[model samples]
Target: MAKLIVSKFGGTSMGDAECMLRSSEVAFGRGASLVVVSATSGTTNDLIALGKASESQPWAEAEKILSKIHSRHVKIAADLHLPTESMQRLETLFEEMGSIAKGINLLKDCSVKAMDTLMSLGERMSSVLCTEAMAQVLKRHNSDKKAMWFDVREVLRTDDSFGKARPLTKEVESLSQKKLGFLRDYKTVVVTQGYIGSTEEGMTTTLGRGGSDYSAAILAEGVAADVLEIWTDVAGIATTDPRICPAAKPIDEISFKEASELATFGAKVLHPATLLPAIRKNIPVFVGSSFDADAKGTWIRKEVEDHPLIRAMAMRKKQILVTLSTPEMLHAHGFLFQIFKIFNDHKVSIDAITTSEISVSVTLDDSTLVNKKLIADLSEIADVQVEENLTLISLIGNNINHTPGLAKQIFETISDINVRMICLGASKHNFCFLVSEDQSTQAIQRLHKKFVEA
Candidate 1:
């Protein structure tokens, strides 16, 4: 069996026919054995909206969205000059989508199960289109072998968790061997859908939004591939979001630990959990731009040659700070446990935490998904103050906690910005603080100049 190279392309890379052609070149030109593709840009959102409308809006309204989605795909297929049989197959998929929407309207309820199935359609459709495009590109180059569409769900089995399913690792490995093992000796480029998995019962589920990267890592590890390539719109991971700070530069190399911190702190380039499988397998991961394949991108591995004081900074906006103050919390041992237990029971993930003798402040992402009952329960233990529209700024590095002068520089740079809460000692790699959302960009730029540019 030859060493496999698994490459994953994000939605923007597969946005249209031209983009698909470029992505195919990246896959085949770079000697990728398997290619995992996300949905065309905006297709998943449209599908979700159509699903929501099925529950409340009339069937006609949902059909309108379905028709729009179908037309987009049809146009792309025609633009790519796909065969008549392939175009008919594309229409068949659109027909299936219409039937699914009609069923959702008739039921008047879009369960998580139904939504996952609908969302899976985006990847399935995109995979079909990409395989055709890549095959054409291969033939044009006079390659004897063509790209093949491999159904990933056949091997990437997971639990019954419909919306955010957890992949069963052992099952995935076994199935990958049984199904993808043949591809090891084959000489064709295998294209598959990302973010979609199936349970043992064969019910379709999703790993979550941005799970396509996770899907790629899973396949690479499952098959023991040499390297996992994540092709996105940007050149690679940057010191900060380029949009927030235009001076932000791309990082050539980073450690897995630092990359994980950046992902957790709100870097959108890679999913936070995408590196777990690759990390365990010791597979080096590459992040590059599909639009500009020749550009130098970031490489994530177990170690890097250099470790800077502040490698990168990330800011997560729309944070909610929950401050609990009570005399009982003063010098109390079990008080902290009680508060944490409530968060655990509610399944709320905290981004940052700071504590005083009599109070504790925590920040969580501001989302409607937060459990209201958790807040109501916390109010019983202590007086809770909730602050909305805040931002979390994380300075990520290597052993920055013990590094002197770094903290001094950070404070001096953002001396004027009001810091709400500071969280340290949680991880050796990061020093995070909360601030008003409006000041986040200014804070990032000042910090980037002070640390990254200097």
Candidate 2:
């Protein structure tokens, strides 16, 4: 039996008519029975802007943004020469979007729930166009395979989180087996939208930014696919971000643990949560460029031949360090729990953390710091200091905590830099530290040269 492959293409891969055609060809050539695609390039951001404008701007202004969005999809549809049915579907979606914008403008309110519904139009429209593209590719190949557009919301069930919903895994698995199991016959190519799912109450919800990959992984696991392919703009995973370190090289293969650490730390190729399902099911994942399908892509698996001490390094910028200090924390067991519970209540995730008897310091994404209520809650128990303009740098590899002299070598390389916080021993795959944002580039370059290049 042929290996079952579920392929996901990023925004740029579906940017325009040509991009969609190329991505369709890649999917077909790779024998992807199910293809998951993101919104066209920049469409999600445009929808977000439309949502904000609808809430604050004049009706005319919101209309203009909506017109722009409509024109984008119309042009792609025209280029692909989509069927009348598909074009009508696109028009109906645009009508719904316009109505939503009008309502939000009149109400002067764009709740997270409304924003999710508005943003979901991006993927919904792209899936229509991509389905036509897939049909054209199948016709061109003169194959008997039928191309079908599948509504992922039919199978991908999530909680009612609206803006960042979590998938209901068991439901997804059962639904996939019942609804998508026909793909096992190898006679149909199913095109589906990613990043968007329906709540148990049937309300539309999104999986947050860069969630397309995560959704694809979830579906792959649900169907028990043999492989998951993530096709993006880049060729594959690199030793380091090429824009930051020009000397960065491509990684042909990587272990799931190291890839997870790299993504959590800041590698943009894969979303931090994308590998979770794949890891649980031990499914191999492929990361490659849809623009250059022939390129050697990176493969992520449970094990690899090489287990280097330092595989790759990542840098996450615009981090905020929150330090909570109080005499109450000294020899206290529940104090840390209280601090963490406050963050949990606010739904803010802490990245790297270090603690002392009297003080606990943690790193968080700069965006999450906008919740003043969280700070206020913490301030009631301890003195809280928020430090911005910080960057978290992580080294992802094997046995990071077990390797002696690793920290010494790293510090020796960047002895001049002031390390604000250090988090280690938590995971053997990662050793992360914080530094000033301005010195992040220099620090990463030096470390890459000393460790990766050498």
Candidate 3:
């Protein structure tokens, strides 16, 4: 039996007609049975802007963005030379978007549900265009079979978390068996949207920003795919962001654990949650550049032959460090518990933590969204200090904590830079710390040179 491969193309890969055509060739050429696509580059952001405008601005303001969305899709269709039927469908979808915007304007409310629905449009439209483009390419290549645009909302079931929903794994598996189980029987390519899923009640919900990668992982596990390929803009996982360090080198392969650490800490190659499903299924995951389809890219799997001491480094910027000091915390048993309870109640996630006898400091992402309220609540118990514009630098590999000289090497490399916080021994794959945002690039370069270049 031919193995079913699930390939996901990121937004940049689907950005324009030319990009979509290139992506189609990859999908068709690779014989990917299932292709999940994100919104064209910038489309999701534009949709989000439209959602915001609809909530507070007049219909005119919303209409401006609506027009942009419509015109963009129309141009893509014209560029793709879509059939008249496909062109009419694109028009209808645009009209529906306009109606949605008008409805939000009339209601003066952009509820989470409404936002989800609005955001889903980008992927919906992209999937349609991608499927049609792939079908046309297959015809051009003399293949009789056509690509099918699949509405994955029907197969991926999730809870009602609205913007950041969680997929019900069993439900997804059951539905995939019923809906997509027959893909093996036919020589057809299935194209579907990423990031968006439906609740059991059929309400639209997104998996969150960068959730498209998560969507692909879930679908890969659900359909028992032999391989899951994540096609994005870069050459794949690198020692450090190439933009940050020109010397950053691509890692040919990495373990699932190391990749997870990189994604969680700061790497943008894959959504943090994308590896969970693949890890469970023990599927071989490939990260490749859609733009450079021939590049070797990176492979992520259960285990790789060689385990380097420090495989890569990732930096997460725009971090906020919150330090809470209370005299009462000294020798108090429940002091730590109290701090954690506040976080749980407010649903604020901490990225890293450190503690002294009377003080505890933690780092958080999306601080702008959670800091003010969290600080207000936390202040009731301790004196709070918030520092913004920090960055978390992480060294990812095997036994990094136990590896001799690694700690000294990292600190020595950045000895000139102020080290705000150091977190170690939490994960075998990572040794992370906090530094000023301004010094992040220097830190990455110095560390990459010491470990990767050396």
Q: After aligning candidate 2 to the native by TM-score, how far in Å is the CA of 171 from where it should be?
A: 0.6
Q: Give each prediction's root-mean-square deviation over alpha carbons.
A: 1.6, 0.8, 1.5
lDDT of 1 by residue, 93-137 (tens): 788788778888999989999899899999989998999999988
Q: Which 10 consecutive residues of model 3 have the lowest summed lDDT?
A: 366-375
User: Which pairs clash inside model 2?
Assistant: none
Name model 3 segments beyond 4 Å from true: 366-371
Computed on alpha carbons, the lDDT of every model, listed in order, comes to: 0.90, 0.95, 0.90
Residue 193 of candidate 1: its Cα lDDT?
90
Estimate the TM-score of every prediction. 0.96, 0.99, 0.97
Alpha-carbon lDDT of model 1: 0.90
Q: Which RMSD does model 2 reach against the true structure?
A: 0.8
Report model 2's TM-score to 2 decimal places.
Answer: 0.99
lDDT by residue (417-447, candidate 3, tens digit) is 9999999998999999999999998889988
RMSD of 3: 1.5
lDDT score of residue 248 within candidate 3:
84
